[model samples]
Target: MDQDDSETCQMCPMDEWPNREKTRCLPKLQEFLSYKEDKMASFFCFLVILCCVITCFTLKKFILYWDTPLVKANNRTLSFTVLVSLLLSFLCVFFFLGRPLDITCMLRQTLFGIFFSLAISSLIAKSMMVCIAFKATKPSSSWKKWTGVTLPYSIVVVCSSVQVLICVSWLSTYPPYQGFDMTTYPGKIIIQCNEGSDIWFYSMLGYLGFLAAVSFVLAFMVRTLPDSYNEAKYITFSMLVFCSVWIAMIPAYLSTRGKYMVAVEIFAILTSCAGILSCIFLPKLYILLIKPYLNTRKHVFSWVRK
Candidate 1:
């Protein structure tokens, strides 16, 4: 009932919510992922910075050893491509940490998707190169044509271009935007990005998953080859970890609401990126830094002969 007339009732303004007693309206609370208040967001920010620094360091080391037999053993171009993509993937988490905005909402997922696809495509190219190199060792083999740089470079470009096209299509059509959720929690306005189209969002993820699956299968096929020229085992392990994290993330992301939902995604992105970084690069780093003697061409050929 209204204060002036017992028969009349009044509604609160958009900025105000009803009190528990329904006697008067109070201001609505704003909710979002805040760096100051959200411990998880702050922690994730720290991790992102840490990962970026590590990637830069690794890239520097690879650059210094650019002419070394070890670096040349793997396709230097593809390795650099993977490292750069992984660095960008780590940085992409920032857009999901701050308050939802029109631009951030639109860019966050698409950027992450594109960067991850690039990394996966590079790994697939690496695996293919290893297989072709092994086959080209045979006398008068047809795989000799693919042993050159052209084939792997073409693979990376073609594979990554498909993902770029998907993201462009998604953004041009139904795109994500900032939205408010008032009904989820009383007396609070939960500000979040409303993914404009679930179909497009899932399609983006599905395409990424498809690329990962292809990479994983290709890597697995070449996993039994000698370690000197074969990075397929590492690629297979990384893709396994990457696929598992996102597969689990889908359900958790669907069930959570508000800030927690964002946290789940950030966690998935960081963990999967870390998986790729550590799995593919760590062993190579170990040899480059710790076992320098093993990086020699003689040792590599010895392993190849055995």
Candidate 2:
């Protein structure tokens, strides 16, 4: 065809582009979650960073009071592990904030699922540890031998390994990639990550929820155990918050499209993780930093009697 008979394409305005006919323009694909283009992404990035800083402060406190009876009573190793996982989970939000590149799309859900699994698994292990501690206090109880860090560490490892395997299978079977949905909205393109398989995504979430539910039930049953330093009560509340946020998130996430959907998942991640961090650890931090006397063995025993 002659040059005049052929078509030419030129760059359109921001968030718009020429249609196939090239005579008119339509809304462009909203591809990126950049700070300049979307303030919501920027806001979430700030939140993630803030939460990370808080996690650091919490870790510092835990290390400083590592020798205290209150800190010792709660398995310190498990505590540190849980804190680190929570921090990683918060940092994972950064993946959701940026553009949905090939690598980010592939790793975001996998890492998020793994980190959350680790956190929930740690909570479950801690709850089991609390139960073991109380049972072992009984004279001649066989649970005494299992009341060490070994069980909790094993629980974290086994639970996390399962998630790792699931993610590996998901990536191996149908890995996610940068996708564009051109028909979702009229005359507009929605750029997002195609999460490959719904089964794998929901399966990961289901498994994490199962761990949380078990943790909640165990912690609730043991919350009344006679120890002022007990963590069962805190675990119960944290699991409640964690389960509630994700449960509500599923429908909201499915109802939205494009960037809003991403926003919903990010919101769920931040809120659920923050719930675990604040509920499980803040009370201990209060005692460790603000009221050191309450962290002593004498105070624990005294409160147990009252």
Candidate 3:
């Protein structure tokens, strides 16, 4: 075709242009409407509160039984074990969510990866703490004193830091998640930190799997410990619940049907709530409230003392 025809093609009538921007400039990245942001923020905020309530109640019970002869008599090393979940819940509430879209995928992924790493590492550290407690009871020897403040925490810091660097590097090198020249939703171009590449997506899966692995080991170690069968059963059940997340999360991330995907995310968060409550909160409640009799010395393991 001649140059005039080509130029005319570009000047095709306004109605003929697919979108106004196709005639002129690059399409703008979509921003979530402030209302949409607020709505999502509010919903997640409520979820945070719900998690906090469950965590705080459990911690309260742990505090109550912490100094009792029953808790100490078990030779538990620390004055508090359940307190960490309470603290993590508070951290999650205060720090996570309502994040700005990072233009630099490097910074964005770094921040996300760091938080993800810390959260999982904290959970794994918890499992290690449980195992150490079990090990302390062995008749053999000096491993008891080995269980203390610094070592497990240090391990967590190291693992989390390593993975944070891994994720940051991946993001720095990839094209930002919006992708190269793809048509996006015009009115609703929401700024989400996408998984930079297949590597990041699968890495997240691997990371969750790793956390589940450690959790399972702890669950196994505690499986046969000489505690009330109910306590043992609850912990095992909770661990199983937690592990199921890794299995479920793959499909959640892969889902691309917009709001359907959001529903999946919501379900995932709800799963977290259930796991935390079942594993950390409700068990403490059973000891402190529902079965307060269990806390009493010389009490028979019966439904009623009648």
Give the Cα lDDT of each candidate: 0.91, 0.86, 0.52
Q: Tell me the tens digit of each residue's lDDT in model 3 across 1-306.
A: 113234454443322223443444333444421325456656666776776676676656666677654454322332243344334534443222443344543353344345545655655565566567556656875778867767667767776777766676666675345322223444334444455677765675467557656656666666664554224444456658766774686576576533334335545545754574666445545666777767665542221232
Instruction: Encode model 2's per-residue lDDT on 103-200: one tens digit a residue.
Output: 99999999999998998888889889888877887799999999876788899999889999999999999888998776677556677899899899
Tens-place lDDT per residue, model 1, 1-306, is 226435666888776797767777888998888999888889999999999999999999999999898888889989999999999999999999879999999999999989999999999899889888889888999989889899898999999999898889889999999999988887888999998989888988998899899999999999998877778999999999989999999999999999999999999999999999999989989999999999999866565577
- Among all windows of 10 consecutive residues in model 2, the one with the lowest summed lDDT is 1-10
Screening candidate 2 with a backbone cut-off below 3 angstroms (N, C-alpha, C), the clashing residue pairs are none
Query: Could you tell which candidate, 1 or 2, scores higher by TM-score?
Result: 1
Candidate 1, superposed: residue stretches over 4 Å from native: 1-7
RMSD of each: 1.5, 3.7, 6.5
> Arrange candidates by lDDT, highest first: which order?
1, 2, 3
Which ranges of candidate 2 are over 4 A from the true structure?
1-22, 25-31, 302-306
**Clashes in each model (backbone N, CA, C under 3 Å)?**
0, 0, 1
Which one wins on TM-score?
1
